[model samples]
Target: MENALSTVSSTLLSFFNSQALIAAYDVEIFEAIGDGATSQEVFEHCNLPESTGHQLLVAMVAMGFVEYRGDIYTLKPDMAPCLLKNGTQYMGTLARHASKFLYPLWANSAQAIRTNSNQRKETFGDERKWFDILYSEPNDVADFHAFLSVLADPFVESFLKGFNFSPYKAFLDLGSGRAALPRAILAANPHLNVAVCDLPEAVDHMRQELMSSGHSDQVDVYIGDVISGDLPEITQDLVHMGWMLHDYSIKTQKCILANVFKALPSGATFIASETPLLDDETGPTFVALLSINMLISSDGGIESTTAQYLDRLCEAGFTNVRAVTLDGPRTLLIGEKP
Candidate 1:
């Protein structure tokens, strides 16, 4: 009973942990201590007042993000990759994104649940849709996609290993944020034609990224919208949409699937990657919490079970609909247009 109560109490005050980490990122505390620094040095480097900055250091130490010894502090070795600005798995963008948007929106989660609607208007006084508000600023768009790419890294590695791209002559990734998958596929199967289709606002950035990565000539970029049915004529034999299906209402998901179905040629393979709930609708913990985040911040987005996703695929006139297990956080729901 004592342990259970302690867990509950910790859960209730979890936001403190999140805010402390975010605050550290905001003040560049992690970067300041990257090479080890005394509290005074860290505060001076970040231009933070000594009293509050010392308090934050103490909090970071307690949170295990920093280690304090011999009057000096250092970023935890394991956490450096995620905390440092130039680290391979830098997550400061995600932390800032949550601090700027998700934190405020989630404050109205109760109202969202009660009304079965998004809390965008309540939180931001913006009546526009989620993406409109989220993509309103260029920095926000960059941060959003940057964090998504970081998060997708693991899934991309797993997908490449677990799935075969050799069977298809041409591949197109729909709503490919950062076009990570297409880029990876092109690298692995240099002979196969690869392309990416995304919203116009995102396409320019993706094209620029491809150019920077020297894939501009290798991979084709097209502007398209799956929900609006404005997709380009997809001649690709295989189409992959990553972590996008759970971003909208079931009705809209169906519509997106239908649109993708219409765009693909006969006998084409389609794959949508998603983090689904367990079969019993119990917690995968993160997916369940993400469902609430979607409720408050998105257009009726909710996590579905694998079975639910397969059923939706089947209903959209997809044949051989099945869930493919990958060695990553996301499940790949695959179907073929007959």
Candidate 2:
């Protein structure tokens, strides 16, 4: 049994090593070439000794990360995705977001367990300014949108099947970054007339995406925070919010939901999807790590559970609440106001 446990531990270590390798690759060290670089050039770029770089490059090549052709060290096919910024779905922003804010705070998982504070302020400051930039700034938010377009695509496909968006004639995607979910929703149910609500910059970006996908005729963008004003020129039968509720405290979450609830028509569905952490999980895991990501990573943050969301929906005058699981790391909390 002890040998089996050790083997499991070693396997987990290899996974962590792979994560490290990926993070390093995201920083572009692998493809940092001046018309492509030699091992000595790589050493200079990485600020490491020539011999050490050679050893590392040889191992990476053996591990299928690089191609060794004559003297020039070239990146392998998969390595270029992370190495080239904005190339081949390179999600460098999420990496920067994770490393800059979430990594160190996750170290306190044990302490967070001991004190049950959600470790919001005890570790990373949940109300910090950096998160504000992440959430509200155009470029940072675009990075986040790009990050999600890749990371959440598979999850959306799986989870969206759990709830039926077909009943609603129109949808208002509040805080819709890249229109990824709405795009999927349209693909699934072609009848939906969608309006995306976000800042002006985001709306502008959304327009370009809608045009590219030939979905411009099906959807429209509305500029302005949903909380501050009326939703859009059009009234929506379904108010869809994907992965936005987990970025606020209970009070702010309620406020946002109330805003959404008010904009939606009677019998309309308010769809909110998040990675719900069961209320009494033992300690740090993916959901807990995500809770940390909500902090210093963004302002007005949290990772609320199903129970909490249910209460908020009820308080905001939503009826017939339902929790639907979206595969792996996310779930949909849909509230219908009738």
Candidate 3:
């Protein structure tokens, strides 16, 4: 009974943990205590009031994000990569994104559930679609893409290890935010042609990134919208889209799949990566909660099972549709055009 009660209590108070972490990132507490710092030194460095700053520090310590010994606080060694700004897996961008956008929008989750719709209008007073409002500001767009690239790092590493790219000569990534996968692909399979297609709003940033990385001549950038079926002429023998199918309703997902199918060459391959529910419809806790986040934030987006994804791919004129398990969080749904 005590263990059950503790679990319930922790679940109820999870937001406290989240907010405290976000607060730490907001005040640059983690960065301040990089090596180690006394409480007074941390408070002074962050310009935070001693009293409340101490309380926040205590919360972080209790949450296992920080260690307190000898009156000095230090970021947990294992957490440095995720907490520090310069670390490869830096999560400060995601923390800021959740604090500014997801936290506020989730306040209306109940109403969204009741209405079966997004609460963007209620939360932000903007009735426009999710991407429109999210990408409206340049900073917001940058933050969104930055955090996504951080999240995609693990998947990219796993993909490079587990997937075989030797069969394909040309590779195109649709809706490639940050072009992380494409760049990684180019590095791993230098013999193949790599390209990225994204919305017009995102193409400029991608071009600049490629130019700065000295990949401008190697990787091509094109403007396209999968939902509108406005793709460039399909020449790539292998195409991939990552973490994009779940951003819309079932109908829209089908539309995107069909559009991709129609655009690809007769013998081309297509793959999409997604975090899907289990066959039993049980929760993979994060994806389940993310489905709720989608309910409250997106336009009819929801989580689907692996079988459901394969069905959608088959419906979209894909043959030999199957799920490819990777050494990462996302599952890749592969299909061939015949």
Candidate 4:
């Protein structure tokens, strides 16, 4: 009976902690309960119906999101990952961005299916100008990069640990924003010579951070559009494309991959670290959430699965392909030329 009860309880908690639960947490119902609020108080605080609020509270308590003692309810530590404000493991953004923007746009994915068009009209109307928007608007740039960095955190040590970077004469980080990803990797591989390829505005920010880190000489700046601008023909042993390939359409991804394929010397490696969509073309739910965000935030990008990426790499004539997950969805897709 105890074993059965535990199994039943686990199922209930999983259901309550789903994306819907995060939305409730976003509205602060869990914290209010922790402050010794009643069901009616929770309803008033969250602007939800009293009957509905009571039901949700009951579920939350059963799921260990809240503990009820008579009329008072308190939040549980296990549930804090979604409820805590700005907590390190806080997953509230999944609900905040997922529900507010991607959810609505995803509701129209059927329209895209019917018309064979991008479901988001507004995102596509600007001719992929969202890149420029993210680049120029400092706040948005910082926020999105922080979001990406958080996603990359769990996987950092895996790829960082796997490769030795000292052989490289120089490192070129393509589409490097704030350059934090490379920053951490550089710390791990101290002898690496580094130069970031990004716009002038972004390099100004990168310079200060790099200089302060005592890497003023190890790291330098190259201002150019990596796609169209003239690239340095240095033939470095390692070039990084962290979290970048999924941001382009397959055609563009192939083009970019082909360019990098040609640029690398023998035994050189190209690393693309990102959350895996799925092995099949159909994505895992977490990646589906991000893919929809890409539709809304980017003009022409969607999260492609490992199969799709491998296809692009093979098509571009890079013979070696490997995928390894560090944790959860955070993964590395490494390709080497034969």
Residues 1-338 of candidate 1 have per-residue lDDT tens digits of 99999999999999999998999899999989988999888988999999999999999999898998999899889989999999988889999899999999988888888999998888899999888888888778778888899899999999989998877999999988788888888888887999899987788778878889999889989998899999889999999998788899999999999999998999999999999999998889999999999888989899999999999999999999999998899999999999
| TM-score leader | 1
* Higher-ranked by lDDT: 1 or 3: 3
Model 1 local distance difference test score: 0.91
lDDT of 4 by residue, 111-174 (tens): 6545544545543343435566555655444445545556666566566666666666667787
Cα lDDT, all candidates: 0.91, 0.70, 0.92, 0.66
Candidate 4 C-alpha error for residue 145, in Å: 2.4
Please provide, for model 2 over 39-135, each residue's C-alpha lDDT reduced to its tens digit, 9 standing for 90 to 100.
Answer: 7778778777666567667766776767888888887766677556756667666666556445666666576556543444665555444435445
Estimate, for each residue in 49-98, the C-alpha lDDT of model 3 and write its tens digit.
Answer: 99999999999899899999989899899999999999888989899889
Evaluated with lDDT, which candidate comes out highest?
3
Q: Per-residue lDDT for 213 in model 4?
A: 67
Off by over 4 Å in 1: none
Worst 10-residue lDDT window, candidate 4? 119-128
Tell me the deviation in Å of residue 120 in model 1: 0.4
lDDT of 1 at 20: 88
Candidate 3: where are CA atoms >4 Å away? none
